[model samples]
Target: MGENSSPPDPVRSFSRLAVIVQLMMLAVVSAGWAISDGTAVAAAGTATAATAAVASVTTPPMGWASWNTFAAQINYNVIKAQTDAMVSSGMKDAGYQYVNIDEGWWQGTRDSAGNITVDTAEWPGGMKAIADYIHSKGLKAGIYTDAGRDGCGYYYPTGRPAAPGSGSEGHYDQDFLQFSRWGFDFVKVDWCGGNAEGLNSRNAYQAISDAITRASAQTGRPMVLSVCNWGNQSPWDWAPSMSTMWRTSGDIIYWGQSASMDRVLANFDSAQHPAAQSPGHYNDPDMLIVGMTGFSAAQNRTHMSLWALSGAPLLAGNKLTDMSADTKAILTNREVLAIDQDPLGGQGVKVAEDQTGRQVYSKVLSGTGRRAVLLLNRTTSAASITARWSDLGLTGSATVRNPWTGTDAGTFSGGYTTTVPAREAVLLTVTSGGGTSSPSPTPTPTPTASGTGAIRGVGSGRCLDVSGSSQANGAQAQIWDCNGQANQQWTSTASGELRVYGGKCLDVNNAGTADGTSVIIWDCNGQANQQWRLNSDGTITAVGANKCLDVPNNATANGTKLAIWSCNGGSNQRWTRS
Candidate 1:
């Protein structure tokens, strides 16, 4: 990856294969590559092309902004320092491609010629030098502007505003042209449509979008258009056609700074839908507020995971040079970031709500066999949520690998359940349970035992005992009498761990926890010995015992004894449909 001496448009020379290979290389560096065939390669190629087509101009914007630690009090010196830091920090090699000047860059008045100019006192060498310096670093420059007629600043931060005869106009096309002339590679146009004095606000956004597209083509520099109208408008539905990414949530104000955790969670919750967003057009959940106002490592990890899972841009609002090691670790976690940058580009959905009101977001990764499940606990109390194997379409058992700990939670059946502390998140990658499906076998005889007596319940309280044991986790179980015992109670946890009401999952008892270890419910902790597979034929088999439920020699008699024996797929190992 060396600089080109040729005069070719370095950006235009980026070919499909080159970009895909680069992305594949990055995936190999960050995420492990799955064994992919032509179909998967084609799918990845298409996704990469879409991403490159819309995102090629400004792939990973890596410039400094004033919003993170310094809000509006930023001057040109700070911008220069950030630009210098981007080069010195080796971030350029990591693909931070843009140095954007957020807000505060504008002054009240234009030049005597009535054209917008950089503030001389603030920007001494003018914007052209800054742009040159950025380009010299193999990166691009970005700037911000408002869409309204009049910028709210008293000095008119963005000139005289778009008022009816203020010598200034609020035309998106004109503004876009002006920005293009400034050599900007990215534009974050905001303050449009939501204001009270704006004219035809809804149409104004669309107008700006049209103007951006037209201007980018005119400049021949392909500027990345970031629509910043907030999530008030469903950007997912409308903004995709306009820009590369639109803000899908209200402005992110930093951890423990602006709003409460509840507000943040609610904002992201409402924005999840229309799971069709791919590489180019993305649903932005606003900027990263991590590492700002002194956020902890754990909090930042939570922020990164949730944002990545939502397919939001990884734009860091915090000052990069002033970051801590812990903060860097959280931000640089490749495993968590891959979930967000996956080729599928699908937004994570709220799978379940916890008792403390936390949420679990499940995002299926690029491959059909993998998933990134984020357990986010937003409340002040420790909360736990369960993802069932059946609910996630997983079969039998899976290896739940926690990304943060870099450790495997062992192969588990049902689903993987983890407890997250308040205001924290747990991100895991789950390899599919191998028992997703079983091979079809020869049909066996259906049981038909004529009995005048009713079937007795086995589990606690009112359980149905269709004359036999219904001893499987996913098995279609019925009600029966309590018998004041572990066999009477059934535990139906969503994570695929089923136990008798007040007992653990029926164990082979020690796991000999012994043969003839009557199926007794025990604590529903995840252990291979306790897990039972509910076969399609209504037979229950213990994973460790390697035995299936034997209906005592396939007797077609009422109240046949249920016992576990080595798996032979015999008639005795099957049960009749209830």
Candidate 2:
């Protein structure tokens, strides 16, 4: 075998943000608390600013991590074995990259220059060799480290190990740079013991993120930086610009483990619902323990389905050397995996949540032709979960196919239902009829005395006002006279595209597909680039650009340049229903 073809060495241990406190904080501090002095008030204001100021950038990562199943028992050889299985088993071809080895791979001491190194005992040929193996197989290698000195002691959270380098930026930066040198493509930085001891846990997390971003720039390799802060401050709000994926929760374990599938489901709910996550950055609910000792193949299938539908990262935390054919099949399901790795990078949102406790996550996948929905049974008993055509907001007729079973879900009139096993999941792949496009029913333009049909603000009263115009293909959609133009009418279609009246489609102005780009109305060319959806929170996101439509200058002025910007819920980006 060639030098780069050598198998990686073997065993080690490993370890691994968001919401609510923010609202309470704003209410209590800004509205309730009053600082008596100017200096004190300024300090309070500054502290109120969060580190994760950006909106959710990427959808959750969709691949595997090693912590949940192997824990500290992971080794270099194990990563090699898993990467091989991932390829031979068809996972890499299906887009499951990021073969991350969690904790224990790092040495307890740094070099005199403050560079972190891999333990030679566990990784004899060095992380570079392991990375070579992974890359040779067409995959990415991820490493584990801590933002704090002594590694944050997260290896055993409750029984802190007194990690010597706990909360050390110098050490953290050194480790990141070293990983970059070793050809590592991803980093999962932990914050266990450092959470309580940092000058401010939030600031400390930001500091590490800044360090990683700098390292990524310095090394000239685009590494995925994942901050595992366990939802202390709202990572959804702050970490998107710095990292690719950040853990929204501590870790998810099933089959009598510390964290159960229930915890995983809850985290999924939080990420999809009122809170939003998007591409470039993701809401990592931790690694997958599916196909591990405790869960059945069916349960694991459901686990994988939910994560994929939610765009959560797919990290397999099982013993790969002993994986069964059924387990391998579940992990490498391409149709299901497509939902997770969809290029659009739009995170699925929760459309239904009932007290009977079932949840549905619907995502818009590629092909300009399909939709993916994961229906999960949160309860321990079997329950019937249905997807109605109306509920999905489909304009005309459609078909739902089971991606997992490879069978037509059997069309009913409006929707379809299947009994989901307790804690299990089902995957639905929806496509429009006959591959032909259908025009949604355009509302009749309600004209005023002036005869100008202007529709203002979509959804909330924030809409465009039109005066005296008929809907046409190239008609100028100006800031109207505000009588509600049906041409100004829009709907979030089942395909997840925000289709407008007439045949035009929403687009990112100039087609500059970068994070934080703005949006505009463009000719519909049946291309994914023209599709867009206004997220429930009123942020407008375009499909082709993979970014949110932003109001430039934060200006609400008429003809304000609508550009594609990152999906942060700022007043500049947040839209209201007209």
Candidate 3:
């Protein structure tokens, strides 16, 4: 990724003259456009991009995943013990029901029929028996797989006996049907092989969803699909349509160790897409690391508060068979759980950051004028953070109750201030203020200025090229070896269009407004789809469609088609203007 340059090609010296000539022309056109219309288009699409959520799970899911504690080192006895522990530990009644058996439960070996087969020795009664046992205990069963032919274990070897071809690549329908036949209530698909093979996350997940639908119809059982691609495709934008939840970041814990507050906060920051979340579809910040090796009770509270405020899934990633009272208390807090499971299903947003590491987060609850607030202290010392009434959409005095302590914190007008210990967060339930319904709003991404340079894909190291150098209205946008051609030269106009070929603007075909919508060259029209925001995160977000310009299949091959997708912070979506 350094310098983002290729070694000198044989024709590089000869092409410079032509590239400079074309570059000058593009600059002239851009200057004229800026002079004529930049001011007029400045306010276009100024409204919030979107506010609707997809229909999926009614609320963020509450469950347990094995990867956090046991990982691939699982067997029938291990899972059965965890399932038994779930009930005995009171987590089941406390709303932690799904007992997920993450990776390592299966070997790569499939039968002649290509059906997924588990380790029979480890699973005496087979996978269905374990699922039945979980169901018998009034808990749902969850399983894991990869999108590619080989699972994650093959690459990371995080757990016992890593195997290859454990993914459901060529057998999407067959494998999902098999899982449905086996009675799994939930499936969390990993992206190890998908990333390794450069698969288009949106297309891959969509195919898996379709397969699951077919399986569900055949089995008469609905299954929850959890997309765990580590935010590579900006899953939030499109995942809700196909999944109950989608992981918005990488693993929270470093595995086999105590979860760190820094990692927890990092994950929280990555999952903040309030506009993309809706009832039944939630952002997943990986599994909860509440009782992990290194977390203090206060640290656990901070972690829990962030996830609850975000309305993210509350999947415990610790060993359930054994628990300390403090761990149990932090995991089973009813009030915090209620906020996460609120029927309103609104994800929280940062209302204020008074200082560098002092942050205030607020989420609207189901009841009128009710809001859940988290005042987080990330500094080295305890800091006094204030939650303002106006920020929480409240007027005058408001009653603040301590949910963790289950006591009233009294009413105050305008704002409430409290001391939060270093690396800790204070969670409160505020109500009964002259409350309005508006949620705290954050500014949309600041647009990256159109510059005269090559827009090179970070992952592919290729330049955005217009296919065939066609001047037609429907010329396809693609990537090719950076040749400094007129097609590869783009002027990010002040008006927000990535313009090339003098007048044709980079556009979403037909203004399709969906993930994987292909990019094309079209006559410039001040349309929303043609407008884009160059983000600091290295993505070009389409202003109208609210999707990122993406390379199909994460491909580096010449002629790879360019499209728009949910912005997952993937390198394929990252572009360097040089």
Number of the top-ranking candidate, with lDDT as the measure: 3
Off by over 4 Å in 1: 1-64, 87-95, 112-114, 152-171, 192-194, 254-260, 354-358, 433-578
**Which candidate comes out best when scored by TM-score?**
3
Q: Could you give the C-alpha RMSD of every candidate to the true structure, in order shown?
A: 19.6, 20.5, 16.2
lDDT of 2 by residue, 1-578 (tens): 00000001100000000112122222233322244541111211122212232212233454567666655555678888888877777767766777887765654666677665556887878778888998998887887776655564433532224345533555656666777888987777777545544434457766776665666678777566777776444455555535566665434653236435544553453343212243444667667777776667787787778778767777777766678889888888777777787655555655554433466555656554456777767556999987644444343557788877778866456557889888688889877553323333333212210111222433233454222333233333334324443445443322233334322345545556876454445434334555555454556566566666565555544544356766767765655544
Q: Which scores greater on lDDT, model 2 or model 3?
A: 3
Clashes of 1: 34
Q: How much lDDT does candidate 2 score?
A: 0.55
lDDT of 3 by residue, 242-275 (tens): 7788886667765566677756765676576564
Ranking by lDDT: 3, 2, 1
Cα-lDDT of candidate 1 = 0.52
Candidates' lDDT values, in order?
Answer: 0.52, 0.55, 0.74
Q: What is the per-residue lDDT of model 1 for residues 1-578, given as tens digits with 9 covering 90 to 100?
A: 00000011111112222223332333442232244531112222122322222244322233445554555456667877777766665555444567887765664356565566766787877776777777776777887766665443432223223222111235567667777767777777665323425343346666776676677677766667776655432444556555677665445563226433433443354344333244455666566766666456677777777777676667777777777777666666667766766765555654444342455556656654576778776546887767655444446678888787778889887777778888778888877846333222323322211111122312221332322333234332233442423233232222223333222244445565244455443333345555555454545566556676454454544443345677666755654322
10 residues in a row with least lDDT, candidate 3: 1-10
Q: TM-score, each model?
A: 0.61, 0.62, 0.70
lDDT of 3: 0.74
